[model samples]
Target: MDCRRSRTNDPDQWIATCPEGSKAVCEELRDLIFRWEPDLKESVNSNMLCFSQKKRVCGISGFKNHAQLTFYRGSELPDPARLFNHGQENASIHSIDLPDGLEGLNLRALRSLLHAAVKVDTEPTQPKPPAAPREEWPMPEVLAAALKKNKAAAAFYEQLKPTYQREYKVWVGMAKQPDTIARRLEETVRALAAGKKWAQRKEG
Candidate 1:
């Protein structure tokens, strides 16, 4: 969908765009947003139809394969069900993937989730570590396990320069427990295997 502009939407009473394949879904979602927050202002930013409470709060975007509701404060969303990937454990970035039809979303549940994302909080996420002091480290057993278990991670490890491999080791070693260490090691390996440098960052 070429969602290049915005106009007033009907039903949900929001102003939005008609991206190609998902035009119907977009219109329905826009109406849903209006129903959820009738007084909210709607606009366009970063190619997504943005809704805000006096300032930027969230937006909806269209894509060929899927759509997404971009929650500006998604990391803080209280999704104890672990619905999102690497959500709270990472920085502020988070997202919920929309299928081609949005058939599974319960309108009330979605509204509640969106409302939680809009709530303000002053806490900054854990700060990114300062650039590591330059050093070389070995490929730990955790990394080796990751490579052995996941093909993509193994490919990534093979492609990374020695320095990058060292970086991965240092990152996994920071986990305080054997279980936590194991989980992170698994995730990092899979992320690397998929050609992702920063798996926590939001992406299409």
Candidate 2:
């Protein structure tokens, strides 16, 4: 999925880009959301179709395996039909995942859920606290020790913009296999020592 925020605000463009089966499901849900509340404003955020009424109420996104309807403040809503199956432990959000080829969604129940979410957004609420400043990615011990051993590399890394630093961190952090992580860590150290961005390294 594209992690970069989309410049396009057109929800249809976002929905049309989904995989075959997911496209239909995404469009269906997107339509339902709008029909449920004509006043709800739609926008694309973080590569998903997000609906807001003064604040974000929900978002829908299509993935390879499923399309998810995520209620921004779903943790507080009642789920008598138990439609939500994910993010239950979260403090603010809850979600329902619709796998492709699944039977039709329970429209009656979904409408009720949407109504409840809308109500929450409409009600008076305490002002949220200001968000904290973004922190640097947590460096793995191996990476840290390597940088410490090379003062030039450490200085170069410290001078990188947060975005570049995040790219390197995500590249290493996403390695699922131990061998892959080890290899990436080694390559990362080499790149930093040479003052090269992660993307500038030759593909292995």
> Model 1 over residues 1-204: C-alpha lDDT tens digits?
235544454324332345466666777777788787777788766567777885666677666666676666676677664445423444566766677466866666677876776664334544555765866666677677767878877786778777666667778877779999978776786678668664341244
* TM-score against native, each model: 0.50, 0.57
| lDDT against true structure, model 1 | 0.65
Where does candidate 1 have its weakest 10-residue lDDT segment? Answer: 9-18
Q: List the residue pairs that clash in candidate 2.
A: none
Q: All candidates' lDDT scores?
A: 0.65, 0.82
Estimate the lDDT of model 2. 0.82
